[model samples]
Target: MRSYHLSHSGAGLAGLTVRTHDAPVPGPGQALVAVRATSLSHRELLVLEGSYVLPVKPDVVPVSDGAGEVVALGPGVEGPAVGDRVMATLFGVEHLAQRGGSLDGMLTELAVVDADSLVPVPAHLSYEEAATLPCVAVTAWNALTGDAAGVRPGDTVVVQGSGGVSLFALGFAKALGARVIATTGGPGKAVRLRGLGADEVIDYRATPDWAAEVRRLTSGRGADRVVDVAGILHDSVRAVALAGTIACVGFVGRTAEPLDPRALFASGATVRAVAVGSRAQFTAMNEVIAEHGLRPVIDRVFPFEDAPGAYAYYAGGTSFGKVVIQGAGSPAGIG
Candidate 1:
């Protein structure tokens, strides 16, 4: 088996190196999967920088989301059968529900995973699209429809930025019958956002006070829900309607402005810090994706050998959607 290891934290992509190891076999209640494709998340960048809140082991294989096929099942593994396409769940069910614990890594050609942690990929989706779902898709789904911030039909949603989570939020919110307002720093993304169901696109670079623009767009009522992917909580506070909900999902910005208690009290809004959700949530999200034929927006796909290049491209901050990596077992001609 081949995998990329992060030799040390804080050294960025330069610290990652390829290594070979004996393939892992499944244990009891586990399944052996031939990994076909994987995707990068912003969280991986934080891990590389040694800034993620959760502690990561040095020299660990470094990815959380991947798609593959079930090749062998261990004793008592009654879940996915041989030849079934499956997606990796970053967290175990209990861990995700209680403490938001995630797996150390999934960047390997072959992995032994608990059968219960795998979800069957929708037949309509290719391996690359399935690989992108386990992390950001589930997170966005939970942010919009989970207990903290449930969006109803005809409600207005404000999604900050055009990253993977933001785009997924836009698609989901629209499918759920909400009107969407998307904010982006790049003017070139306006057309794409609109195509993805954004009713209005606000260029944050052009309009520094984007919250005000959101208010104006909604006739002063403000958005019912704000997907705060940019992590500007104060701005999300200002942008949401009275009694609305704000899903705090990312920290793309350098510094978050302090929240003013008085302002929050006056606005009567709720702020929920969202983590990538549980197996149940992932299953539900996949159901929606299958029903709606929602394909993830893929910015680029790099071959496994170019894992370092993929990291460098993600760091460059110009991609409009999820960046995927095709594994050795990926279907020929897929990317």
Candidate 2:
């Protein structure tokens, strides 16, 4: 089998290389999945760069979001049947506790997942579409409704950037009957976000203080929830919300700016920091995606062998949604 592994020198996409390796049989309680397609996000770059909590050793497999079919099962495994399409969880074993840096196991041509960690892809989606859901989708789901918080119909929600997480957040929020206010640095992305059910799209580049614009749009009450993908924009996120709920998920903005703690007190707001969620949350999110017939926003697709090129493109910020790599020669349902 062929796999893309990280080089020892650095975490850049250049460190990712394709190599051939023996395809091993599954062990006890495990299932061998033939990967159909996989997707990319900033997290892949973090793992390659050795910044992820569960840092990969040199030559470790290099992606997390992938979908495929179960080809073989190990002893005691009765979870998925052969020919069943499935997606692997990042922490193939961690079902509960927040998987920190220790859960680094999902990117490969044929991943051996535990029976408990794999979930069936929603019926309405293709393998490529299912491949894009696990991490970003679950994270967005967790950020928005994980706690079973109140996000009533017609309530306003703000999403920063149209990247994977924020885009999924926008869709999920809309599905719950909340109006979404999306922010984008790119011109076309604002239009695209609006088309994705965002009631308003703010160009943050044109209005750097987009939080104020958000307040203006909301008649100074701010939004009910703000998906803060740009970690540095914490203050701005706080600035625009009505009374509570700021979900901080990404750190696209590199700067660590100071924020006024008093703002939260004044606004009576709640800030929640979310990482990619658990298998349980992934399962729940899948149900919602299935019920709503939601399709993941795909920015581009590259050949599996071109994984490095895909990573480079992801780093270059040229894509509007998820960047994917199709498994070379793999069938739609057979990994």
Candidate 3:
């Protein structure tokens, strides 16, 4: 089996090196999956830069999102059968009942995963698209629909940036019948955001006061839910409606400013910090994705050997959606 490991932590793609290892057989209650595709997230970038709060062990597999087929099952594995398409749950076994567990990332050609941690992929989606769902999609679902912020029909949602979480938020909010206002950095992404179901797209670069624009678009009511993937907490506080919810999903902005207590009090909005989610949440998200026929937005796909290049592209920050890397064992037709 071939795997990409984070051999060193630095500022560039040089840290990730491909290495060969003997594939292992699964133990009881586990399944052996031939990895088909894996996707990158901003979290991985932070890990590479040595800025992430969670310490990644050296030589660890370094991507959280992957989809593959179950090739074999160990004794007592009674779930997915051979040939069933499955995606990994980001968190490891212990996190299924708790919060804040670390992920055993999936950047390998083959993985032996706990059978309970795998979710069946929808029949309509390709391997690459399914690979995008485990992290961003589940995180978006957890942020918007989880206990932190239960978005109702007719509510208004404000999603920050055109990243995976923001785009998934747009799609989920629209599916829930909420009016979505999305913010992006430029005009080109504004058009793409609208096409992805954002009712109004704000170019944050042009209108630095995007919170005011959100208020204007909402006729002064402000947004009921703000998916703050960019970590612009102050702006999210300003744009959120009174008693609304702000789901803090990312730190892409690298902002260092402390939250103003006065602003939070004035808005009366709840600020919830979201982790990716549990196996239960992942399953629920998959159900919703299948129900809505939601095909994850994929900006590009790279071959397995070009995994480092995939990280480089993601670091360049121009991708409109999830960037996937196809594994050596991936079906040739998928992409």
Candidate 4:
């Protein structure tokens, strides 16, 4: 099977190249998937840049989000039969009772996922769409619901940025009937976010103190939940909530700043850093998505051979939704 691997240059994703390799045969308890499509998240940039602590091998396959069909299953694998449509969860382990470790990468024409890590794709979703769910989608779900911390109706939730995780948060929050407040750096995105069911939108670029605006919008009550994807705005997050739960999931700003412990103490708020989510969470999320017929927003799809180009497009940050690379001869399905 044809595959793409990291080049020797260590030049990040820009160093990725396409190459032909023998199709992987399933090993014991594993399954070989005929990958249909894979989606990109901003966090992949961290992996490519070697900033993430995962310590990826120089020539290892990149990416951790995709959907495919079971072509074959290894010995003792009976759950997913051949031709079953499935998506790979980030962590092969279903439910890690504790935190640590990372999920497998899924950017390729095919992937070898443990059978237990696969989630059945909803019959209503296409491979391209299902490809978008595993990583960011599950992370958003866990942030809101997986920890037994359910977001209730009428609660005010804030989502920062218009990226994959934030968008998922907005969608999930909306499904729970929670009022959503989304922030975007672009004015156009603010409009788009409102259309995505956000009750309110803030243009961070126009209003640097967007968090304060969030507080004002809530009549000084502050948001009940804030999903912070913009690391630079962490302090802003601290300013916007009254005893809110803040889930830090990204570092779009790429800088570290001093945080006031007093602020958090004063508000009696909790700040938690999320590293995506578990396979169990992925399964739970898929169920909700299928139930709601929620289709993930896909910004663009590139041919498999042009996977590198897909990364370039993602780097440009021009897309409003997920960017994907479809496997050869595979049909596009946006879930």
Which one is best on TM-score?
Answer: 1
Determine the backbone clash count of candidate 2. 7
TM-score of 4: 0.92
Model 2, range 1-335, lDDT digits (tens) per residue? 88766664255666666778799798999888988889987777777666665544555666778888899999999779998989887665744321112332445677777767789999988888888987888889888886556677888988888789998999999999998888888788888887888898889889988888888899888888887878854565455564568878878787858767776677777778888787788998889898999999888888887777788889888788899888878665322
- Candidate 3 lDDT at 234 equals 88
Which pairs of residues clash in candidate 3, taking residues 3 or more apart in a chain or in different chains? none
Worst 10 residues of 3 by lDDT: 95-104
lDDT scores for all predictions?
0.86, 0.78, 0.84, 0.78
Tens-digit per-residue lDDT, 1-335, candidate 4: 67777653246766786777788888999998998888888757766676754555556677778888899889989789999999877766545311112433566666777888788998888888888888788888877875445688998999888789988999999988899988888878888898889899988789878778888899988888888777754565555566678877777866747667777778777777788777677777878787888888889999988888898899898898899889888865534
Which of candidates 3 and 4 reaches a greater lDDT? 3
Cα RMSD (angstroms) for every candidate in the order listed: 2.1, 2.5, 2.3, 2.8
lDDT digits (tens) for residues 187-249 of candidate 3: 998998988888899998899899999999999989999998878898889899999999999
TM-score (C-alpha, index-matched) for candidate 2: 0.92
Name model 3 segments beyond 4 Å from true: 9-12, 96-104, 332-335
For every model shown, the clashing-pair count is 0, 7, 0, 11
* Per-prediction TM-score: 0.95, 0.92, 0.95, 0.92
Question: Model 3: how far is 206 from its true place, Å?
Answer: 1.5
